[model samples]
Target chain A: MTDGQETIKSSIWFEEAEADNPYAAASCYCSGYDVYGDLLGKVSWVQYLYLLFKLDLPDPQHARLLETLAVALANPGIRDHSVRAAMNAGVAGSTKASALMAAVAVGAGNLGGGREVYLCLDLWHHLGSDMEKWQHAISQPSQDERIDVWLPMEHFPGFDPNGVTCPRPVVQTLALLADIGSYQPLIWLRDHRSELEAATGYPLSMAGVAAAAFHALGFSSEQAEMLYLLLRLPGAAAHALEQEQHGWRQYPFFGTALKPMADADYQSLMKTTEAK
Target chain B: MMESTRNSLAYFDNHWPTNKGAWFPGEAVRYREMSLFDDFRDKSWMDLLIYGIRGTMPQPEVSRLMEQIWIICTSYPDPRLWNNRVAALAGTTRSTGALALGVATAVSEASIYGRRPDIIGCEFLISTCDQVAAGGELDVIVMEYLKKHRSIPGFGRPIISRDERIEPLLAVARELELDRGDHLALVKRIEDVLDRKRMRMKANISSYCAALLADLGFSPREFYNTVLLSFTGGIMPCYLDAVEKPEGVFFPLSCSKIQYQGAGIRRLENVKK
Candidate 1:
């Protein structure tokens, strides 16, 4: 190449002819796909999801566990933050898509939502690999007591010692499935329930259990929350639809009555503060 | 519910520790044993609201008026029944100030400006205060703003016929012997003119804050920032309340309870093509 042409090329751009790609289309070569063309027609959606997330197809047992876990967490009910947000949006005459987005926004802020789940998953991975950190976490007081400071990844209260409404069918089913699949995390949670409870004042939370399962399954921390959002979307949509059909502008909870500020009280309160 | 001393302490305790972790990182590190509003010992709410406005604090009367105004703002909508109750619930519709603000703040700087009507109202009032301070007539300035916008900022509120805070704020301002500042005088004059004109507008809490900020020589931006900082502590109790609920489910509803209005199910293939 001419010096002038080479200079222009170098200054403008450098072509990446041998750049590696993590995804591919219309080709046999792809992550864990000997034949992408065949897998497209043959693989189940759940199997494909597993491959996409794990970068490898799951065995039958692992596939069932992952599928069941997703199903169990899918639509927790109208009480769920995301579901109620969606329904409220729908009641306010928002479009279906807007309602769903509203629901996602609310859900994304909860303790089990994307941010907290990501934290819990991160802690799970950290605690799994590091014994010292695990020891510290177990020794810490219940999350409620130490409101002064908090780490995002803390509070996997699988069983809140103070009473947790663990959806009975789902939790029991997951535990049973975990046994059949021989997943160590689920088994560990089941076997060491009392010990873990003793270590941390709160029992293992639903999200904590899910985090442990995700960690054991080799899913990354970031993937854990995205996976949750995706699973919960349909549930939120269902609530939005229901709200559109039967709900009103307001929820059941009556609003707080505003106290008219009595002049006497205002004076007294001011005087009290001044006196203090 | 009557806010007992214990409940008040709980409200303060819930917010102070979590403030550093959740939102405002600028708060000084606080341990468990420290009292609520501990950082502002002997400092009244007015002092905190206008912290950076002037090197010297306002006259003692201004301080007292500001204190009364703060009390009026904080006293209403009981914290236990509202902030720590219904309004702060996670699924609370956008009707609640906290939920709406929560969503608005989530958007980056590109979208934060328009969500806060109180801030907008304060900004407009601050600008008007500038002109009045520059010797502009309150009637002419207000008329010009009303001609363009059909409503005056810092006056009138939705969901209520009268603002409860105005009279108490004025009473407190008068009691404190600081009722005659230029901004305050102009605001009262505007209220009188509006009343005579049959325009049902009354000064609200923002009006009081804006007057105090302007009298203290705060720039419009400083007024906005300072007022928001003052009230940001209020939203924390709602958040703490919501999180304490089971699964953090606030103000829950059963699916069958919802009323649907959309079109019934229609098959895609059944439609004429």
Candidate 2:
């Protein structure tokens, strides 16, 4: 506040004014780190990313864990909902921005998506490493204080309802990251996988794993969500471009999935409507 | 697997099944049990949309009122709206019409405003009506909702206290003779409580339309489905107007507009580089 009146300002970044023009920035700063002068070649993207969000540079271990999580999360595969959404846009000649937008829209869901990861992080934050608390919360999902935004956790967030068994990738990724950091929640989650699976009656998804890792790395649920969304876009972008090249005819169709209504069914339906 | 098997309408058994109808090119398209070419070719666009969601034709007046509701909301083409701004930006970037409209429409499903609150408002009216029918006191029902939610959806608005669209919308409903719904009556009574309790913060369009829709026997899911593209008509004009302008002209911000309150630049001498 200049004179006790607070002027709105961005806390994330600022640019030093050039000598000649006030409107231009000569040097850029992000969370207090000099972008070009201090960090450009010296720091890895992972460390830089950590500093940008957390406003402090990460230790090597933290950077390594985050970089591992980032690589594992980079591509969610062709069958993934977010990737398919981008692919659909690409095949139909949607703009490049549209392709990414499609991915983000589809990815922002409570089921095996960024929202699930965020919720899982919140769970970690609230009930850290307590098996009893985790079980109770998963069993009842303590009611949301406000009823306006998210749908109630239908089937515990982060665990895949449709999963038949714990996927090999989830197991492998958990093993890789769980050992790196002393984030009690991740280690606890890794050790108590069976108990959690038993409680929720489903397998741990990549979202659950990533949420645990991100939480351990000191990212908030919101930060984890934003990072999760952006980090997963590379795969979506590649798949969309591929699908666009392949064309709509080459794209897989679910047309056979649609069962045509019988004439008898049609007549019955119309008759029922008239009766109503 | 064991638990999901019990709830498996959508499952993986090397088959993806759909009860929602499909099209056979050159023959016809099937919408549930109705033939699009044979039964629905003569139907209005709104009729098709409503039928697609509800699986039955509404009465003529119900159809008229629903269309009128869409038309009433369509008068807003102002790009400054939260959802419409996305559309305007998309236009300024010269994005495709599909993406511009699609993204903006997606943005309209916001938490505090748009479809989320509208659905909540509708559900509140329906559930309250049900409770009152089941011997619950009206005052207790409303008071409990306020206590639980801390805020009521349809009873108040941001930026302005009263809703301007309510009167015009109610007038159309009256003209169509579709105004006298039980839900509508209860909603007004609930509004009386809110006006007295919440310092004259009157009910807005969401609760009003929600009450009306609930009165007309719309389930919350069905109401959501039908009004999915409710903002498209307004969003389209803003997008179209923006696309006709020079690139990035919709709302351009220069560097000076930013208030940089972040840390000052530091020297790199401490670094090991």
Q: Which candidate's lDDT is highest?
A: 2
Off by over 4 Å in 2: A1-8, A16-27, A36-38, A141-152, A261-276, B1-11, B267-273
**Model 2 chain A worst lDDT window (10 residues):** A1-10
DockQ, per model, reads 0.02, 0.29
Residue B268, model 2: lDDT of 45
lDDT of 1 by residue, A59-173 (tens): 7777777777777777868776678788887776676766866766666643556666666676676666454566577666235311111223334434333333334664585
Task: Write the residue-wise lDDT of candidate 2 on A1-276 in tens digits.
Answer: 034333348766777777887657777788777788777888888877887888777877888899999999889999899999999989988788889988997898888788888888888889888899999998887776434445667778778887767899999999989888576767878899989998988898899999999888889999999999988999999999999999999997753443434566644443444344
What is the per-residue lDDT of model 2 for residues B110-176, given as tens digits with 9 covering 90 to 100?
Answer: 8667888887878888888999999998888888888887777777776677677889999999998
Window of ten residues with lowest summed lDDT in model 1 chain B: B16-25
| C-alpha local distance difference test of each model | 0.55, 0.80
Please give the lDDT score at residue B257 for candidate 2: 53
Worst 10 contiguous positions by lDDT, candidate 2 chain B: B264-273
Q: How accurate is candidate 1 locally (lDDT)?
A: 0.55
